[model samples]
Target: MQTPRPKTRRTFIKNAALGLTAASVLPRTFAKESPQPDMSLSYQDLPQWRGFNFLDFFVPNPAHARVKTPEEHFKWMRDWGFDFVRIPMAYPYFLDIDYSKDITPEEVYKFSEEKIAHVDRIVEAANKYGLHVSLNLHRAPGYCINAGFQEPYNLWKDQDALDAFCHHWELWAKRYKGISPDLISFDLLNEPSLREDMNDQHGKREAVPAETYHRVAKAAVDRIRSIAPNHLIVADGNSGGHVAVPELADLKIGQSCRGYWPFNISHHKAPWVYKDPTGLPPPKWPDGPEANREALIKFYQPWFDLKESGVGVHCGECGCYKETPHDVFLSWFGDVLSVLAERGIGFGLWEMTGDFGFLNSGRSDVDYEDWYGYKLDRKLLNLLQSV
Candidate 1:
């Protein structure tokens, strides 16, 4: 085994910009108050699952392979009143393979016992902490939104990729068969591509249609349902969770969206995004050059429509980078959380302690302390707690 290297800030940013790429509940009391349609999944549907993504040792790195999130951490989260955790995992890390060699059905489909046990520990911790866990494949078989990483086959077009993808999920479904859906949920893929890159011989940039994405997603959903019919399936919206796929409305699964709207504010100084916010007007709360209440709501219309149709909605990933001002973060977060709460949507902050995180994110401006075995970002932590 190789020494696992800690994931760097750049890598974290890439995942954040992407996984930051990708809710619920209520009813009954409204009968006397008014005829309010439950626009989101009930607390019972998701158990008010709300917290952060724990990526201390996600995937793709060999260094952190033996790492395990301390069970105490989950207990701390529960003590803090958080009941949800989204764990973004990478499939490649758990497979026994030589990247130098051509991937075969045997290699891609096989699981490493060590990695499998690591994930099992995570699930056990979540159950003990009473947290609802959303297991996500940050880097799936053929689709990884992070640029520069290439897959030999296109997940949407290649049969092998699709088969391997579904098989990987089937294994998970089989492994955690008895785990109740109320405790563990499956997040099919991290930010799926906006459009499938069509490398035509003419050197043109053609793209696949949106409906095609639905087909790809449904295939995975169908496979998982075949074995784990009761497991809750959560599918992320396309294009970094910026848009919703209406085709998935009838799929009977939860919908996920992001909170990095009006990127200038949420992703200020983010190296991954193309637009330069160097001279862009500073973002303000309720009214800014970028991201205001109306703008945020407008961007969420499609997702809102999905919720109105009685589908579950969750903001799987959402937050501003550490460079973002504290006040600005609070303002943006306040509005975002308010809207989510109003719509009865459940959300998980981008992360817990790095990059787009509340603690130990390397923000020089904020005061911090070693609390509960982690650097605590008091201001940000307070803001999140208030919500």
Candidate 2:
């Protein structure tokens, strides 16, 4: 990635102007002013929250190859009118150094002071920028969404894995106990999409039903609340945050939903999403907005019920791949954002930079310019700002 340019006064003004333009044409659903919904979860009772996931350069252990430091990232996000940052992290960075082929429960449960300090640095930066930090475990002990890969333990089934996972959360809760929930929150796992048919390397089907996820998540929540009772915990609704987990409603934790409905449009030709896009038909918005809306309403009905029951509902990950036509992407994005905002729900775009970000997502059809040392996707940025 190229070094991002410094944000200058001229750039800020230009961006602000673009945002104002978008605000003028924003869908009516999000245009109306409404009070934010009250939350039953005491820790999340804050103002309307909006931000993007910052996953750039967050790879496996010793992650220092990013284009910007945590402080720089948070500062930029805050200055751009964002109030939240979802930091999706891989766990290897926090694991013990002595581990080899076989990772023990000790290794899984242990956390290096250096790694904890690294996270602390991010949290401190978030505070400096007045941005809430949602620390997320994209890859956990025994399961991940990535296909054709397996972890040492299956978090949904193995007691050791579940215990280790809970212990890790416990450690985090203890570390950030005194911090206000306004400053920091924990997103226990990311995109828990397990397939009942898929087999792990050891030939075991690592299938996790909704009940299993509820159990593990409840246990983790219990562990966290044991110390930091007010800690805000979020669990990814299964299948990329699109599927609802009603079983988790009783847990009294927040649920992170996905906005990537009609995946062919959101993930169009994205390599990670499909091995072959040749067969996919082109997508158009408003072509079936009603159907799309119905799908979203149905998929999110349970979550809405949970919200009605007082649980906090949030769309933690939602964005279309850059390769999709810009107009189509915007049309789809507008609908999703409108739905979320109308419901007084909080959301964050999948990423702030790189493959699925607001800036420099490598869309071939779009023109770009350097802003803050990164290629600025002005239109997309404006659309995000408008909502």
For each candidate, give its TM-score against the true structure: 0.80, 0.80
Q: For model 1, how does the per-residue alpha-carbon lDDT over 1-387 read when each residue is reduced to its tens digit?
A: 999999874355334323321200011121122122324234224444578887743646555453466788788779888888998887767755675555544455555656566677777777787888888988777776664334557787766677667766777766664666667779998877643542221122223357777787788899888876777888888766667776776678887888887677787776665345477566667665445887777778887787777777888988988767778877888788777767777679988767788767877677788886667887777766766
- Give the TM-score comparing model 2 with the true structure, all chains together: 0.80
Q: Which ten residues in a row have the lowest lDDT in candidate 1?
A: 22-31
The digit string of per-residue lDDT tens for model 2 on 1-387 reads: 999999874355445434433322221221222232233235233335789887632554464436545478678888789897888876666654453355554455445555556666666777777888888887676766654433666676678677667756666776676666666788998887665422332233233587888888888889888876765788887765676666787777787888887777888988765767787777887665455666666656776776777777788888988788988898778878877777778788888887678677888877887986788888888888888
Error of 1 at 377 (Å): 1.4
Model 2 residue 264 lDDT? 78
Reference-based lDDT, residue 378, model 1:
76
